[model samples]
Target: MRLRFLAFLLLASGFGLSSASQEDSPRIGDPYFHSSGAWGQDFRDQWAFDAIGLSDPYVVWDALGESPSPVIVAVIDTGIDWNHLDLSWGSLWTNDNEIIGNGIDDDGNGYVDDRIGWDFLAGTNQPWDYDGHGTFTSGLIAAEVNNGIGMTGLNPYARIMVLKAVNNFGRTRTAYVTDAIRYAVDNGARVINLSLGGPSALELETAALDYAAQNDVLVVVAAGNEGQDLADYAFVNHPAVITVAAIGRNGERSTYSNWGPQVSIAAPGEDILSLRARATDTLMNITDAYKPGSAIVGPDKRYYRATGTSFAAPFVTGGASLLWSRNPSLTANQVRQALLQSAKDIGASGVDQFTGHGALDIGAAFAADPNASIVAEISSVHVVQSTDGPAAEIIGTATSDRLEIYRVEIGQGETPSSWKPVAQGRSSVTNAALATVSASEFAGASVWTIRLIVNRTGGTSQVTLYRLSLG
Candidate 1:
């Protein structure tokens, strides 16, 4: 129960935010485009792309042949545009068990006949994006790529599951937010993105996040747009969520973006304009100069572009989806750790309030070895007190195909004897479950050396050993 509670706390705390007023300023020029092309036309060639060195973290074009489709990412914000060309392929999870309108709770998770996704704001099945915020956010995360249409998304191949927590007015009640979170977790969302937040903190919201993490769901949230330190506010201080800050094309922190020690990583936020519905396919650049009334009309016939930390959160969420899609075995903690470790350090050396770890380096994260061992290899083995217990767990692998545990004699001040088999089993090549060995056999041996023996079979496998003490 305690472990479960800790897990819940970890998950809830991971949902990341803050809010601030927008000030008018000069618009920064496009950092990615050359003189011959509009940044919008050739944005992929921008320095931001070169600095991060990633082309659509979600596409995985090079890895398509080797990996399976990525996991589903749940966007809990304003509703997404179901008909947007870039996002049509990346809509929410369909409840195939339930019929569209006959009014039956077929799947029985509480909501009724939710064929598409839930709308916590309206408290119904209608989760259409009236404000276009959710649509833009979704587009950044999983909009389809190489369709010869609009802009490519971070994780184009990843599925986008929408959960409308915020209303058309961009306001969400805490209770509704909590319900939406639980719904996402129970329904099979691996990555949950929260782009909306409030000044008030609720225990229910925290608990919902906790539940999601315990269930193996990753929660990515925006560091508040208010440039204030997050340590000063309880609403944004949760530890379970991976809080993200907004950075600009110059690799500098967005002036309007929030800062705090809780921030995990920074991503491109300033001047980012995504697909919004309007008469023509037009883009609205959000910048320091972005005023409250500025809007653009696209084919979908909607207008938007009020920038905040709210927009920055999805990039990280989308990037996580891409990473998780490639490596489904990665836990939420492991994913968070990878993002932090792989980030390009900014502000100060090590972590600080301004930028957390640094700007997120999607290329570094995508290129990382997901199955790398967390434990160090045993060079020299020493048994300090091997009283009355089984032999120490010999952690090794017969090969990439099998995990093998062994029991070996360890003489004091002498070379360890030959390895003797203890337990062996076949797990996923990337072990979803770990191997465990008991230490009851070496009950009274005072001195012994524990050595791990490996037998190469199909491929080289990494093994981890743990010393268990029995009183």
Candidate 2:
């Protein structure tokens, strides 16, 4: 099981994935119009935004250019308003294998004219949104950025596959969800988002979910909103689904959000602003900003604030999409593990019912994904024989069959509950090297951890402690 780590202070910024060569990170356009989550500045209004580490997703986007077209993410909810200004068709999934406007299942995948995606509820070629939930969730996952119409999501360039499983009325049948899952897996979707769930499980839906898992497609599902503990999640319809819970902007469990052990992680779910549908229909019936700055007025469109476990699940879904964009070869399980490992522990110590592993930290997730290969540990915790007196200095070694330069990080804390980075690198050695920690700093800290991670320059990174040496 992955144990949750306490929230460290704003980590060292400008962290890039450096190979032994240590080249600069890849480039992209400027960031959206909000406070970027880079240097620890709190964009107070959207606490969930910074809480989930969305402050600096642009760093990943800048380093990793465009996501591959085939790495499509299927949002299985109410249909999306693909024509919204914040959504770029460039990032929208198109079934090029099938010809559009032709009344035929050209790709022979059982659907006709699925140009971008299918509408399982309406059984039509147009998977457009008549309601706002799908649109809200979609914008949170992959809103077009720097093009400057509205705000951005995790990966600005991630490809989205629209699947309408929930209708405008917020009603859904097991068959609709099951069929949508099958459709997404059949297509090139690497990640599937199910922002809707029921109070009970159906055999067909369970089989469909298992099928996605078996086929190596990661499914991000929402824990029910009953606000009651039901096993792992507060309440769960599917006992074994990759469940998610909801937290407010302040990083507390939402009053209506379900919780428990079943929850994997959490994200900003309260009044999360995203793309608004052209139609007046809505799920929460919230037409405009309930408060000031809640919704952003765009050039051609508007993004409104929404709340629910439904909105929370997309944070993980979008994260999975970005990881795949960084490296498509990563397996579904690998993606899931990276997310769980990088999560921030909140509320109670370790994994609690309310916040699961804690709120999603995309920056940490990027740094802790499957790219790094070095393992480090504190070899010996010894007090140095100083010329004047006994002092503290940690000695550690690392081993990586992979030839790459590594850097050592020394963090100090008064108690296990908190840690602050005391020292960072200048030493970059290949394969084998001793980690150097300052005696003065080490002596001051009551507790500490040593990290020896790769200093490679690739577009993507894994957010992990690598081999940790707790002192």
Provide the TM-score for each candidate, comma-separated. 0.66, 0.67
lDDT of 2 by residue, 107-132 (tens): 88988999989898779878888877
Candidate 2 Cα outliers beyond 4 Å, as residue runs = 1-32, 35-47, 65-70, 231-240, 281-301, 369-471
| Model 2 per-residue lDDT at 44 | 28
At residue 471, what lDDT does model 1 achieve?
42
Model 1 alpha-carbon drift over 4 Å, by segment: 1-51, 56-59, 232-235, 278-306, 369-471
How many clashing pairs per prediction, in order? 34, 23
RMSD of 2: 13.3
RMSD of 1: 13.5
